[model samples]
Target: MSLAKQLSTLMIAAVLLGLGARVATHSDLPFWGHWEPIKLVAPPISIADDAMAKPDSAFAKSTSAYEVNLAATMVLHMKRNKSNIHFVDAREDTLYKAGHIPGAMNVSFDHIDKDGDKFLALPKDDLIVIYCDGGDCHLSHDLAEFALAQGYGRLAVFTGGWAEWSKETDLIETGSGAK
Candidate 1:
């Protein structure tokens, strides 16, 4: 067959197959399913706005200015300043042993309660930067929130966490786990 004719035939066949599947499945259309519209819900109240919200417990990431992490470079800056700040790693001990941000103490979520006294012992006004593996890891968030509950106010989540720190060759450590 001619080149143009062959190309046209191929295109037609693809379209027919697509139509066939749509009809067979009785679906909304290709690439979209069921034709059903998603239900929209009202946005939830911010934790800060809730009257019953415990001031001591919630990290209130969205509500507080100081609770959020400084940028990674700022964290490095803090490290070099000889400031009395704590770096906490919220990932697993095994991961912490493999590699973590330098000077970051391993404080995994699974053992937070066990390590409660250690954290509680720190001065509430001292700066603490909690981190984990980053990018979908919620350990830091949970731990920071928990710490806030325990009256540790000078909290910040190292938002970039270990993932960002690991990329900086000079900022990572190994075999630092207490285990």
Candidate 2:
């Protein structure tokens, strides 16, 4: 076979193998799923529908994720410690045990099937802030999407996650307790 033709055939075989493995494993990923079109601007704000949006809030909305800064996260963490708000750390147990926001719950995306119950128990309308390791972490976003799918009314993503929080605050709790 010619080089071009051989390469094309190899690519086709790889695709077929991938699809076969996906079918065999019964992966959660859909073979054909509806995708939202990419938009240049942020998604429309549904937060204003409820009274959740604050005049001094630093939150920005994108689909199911609401991005917040360190200041907002600190304010939310204060509420979390007072048991008025729920903050979920999407990092794994090991990382969580090493250090985490004092009252935040660790619900890892990798083990969502096991850790998902904590998320399910939360009130749908309650404001939940999810975070992971700062800078390019998607665990928080993944958990937020799952929460949104399960009818969570309000969700926020702390873009400056544990990395930022740990560095900026002294309220770090080591070891997993009752949370």
Candidate 3:
């Protein structure tokens, strides 16, 4: 064959081989058939809101500015009363030991759940203030929710928590579970 004709034939063969390889490689796929129509089934919709109207605990909602400020004020009042109010630190021991609100008792979320019934057996009406590491921490919220579920109506969560309280030089610090 002439040089130009040979080159053209070679290119054509290469193109055909490439097309054949693609077709063979893709033939096993379900959607590769010429006339196959694909049908996608949508996932089942969940009606969770209808099944459960509200969260188990009302305190899960974001704390209002007034609530947070009031909680802080209450902590101060509790400090003065000493024997009346119970302040629980929900953060880990390391964080609590570093620095926490004065007289705050360290009762982690893990410990409370183990003996949930006994842990919550205290007077539900007693004033309980729960706090965690800081504004970003949710341990206090979890503790408050646990308390609320156990029929504690006077439970309060100090949203600002240790971070905000630690900023004050004279607020008082028990170095963890002192009180």
Write one digit per residue (lDDT tens) for candidate 2, span 1-179: 89999999999999999989988998766568786532222232333333233512333323455666787677666656443468888999999999988878889999999989988988775677889998988898778878877877467778889999989888899899437
| Steric clash pairs (candidate 2) | none
The CA lDDT of each predicted structure is 0.62, 0.74, 0.57
Candidate numbers, best TM-score first, in rank order? 2, 1, 3
Worst 10 residues of 3 by lDDT: 38-47
46 in model 2: Cα distance from truth in Å? 17
For residue 29, model 2's alpha carbon misses the true position, in angstroms, by 9.1
Q: After aligning candidate 3 to the native by TM-score, how far in Å is the CA of 117 from where it should be? A: 6.7
Q: 1-179, model 1: which lDDT tens digit per residue? A: 99999999999999999889888989754475666432211122232343213322323333222333334334333443354567788888889999976667788887887866666776776666677887898788788777766766556666666777677546567897432
The predictions' CA RMSDs to the true structure, in order, are: 13.1, 5.2, 17.5
Off by over 4 Å in 2: 1-34, 37-63, 81-83
Candidate 3, residues 53-152: lDDT per residue as tens digits?
2212222322211134333434344443543456778877777788777777777786675535544655664556677866678777777767655566
Count of clashing pairs, candidate 2: 0
Better candidate number, 2 or 3, judged by lDDT: 2
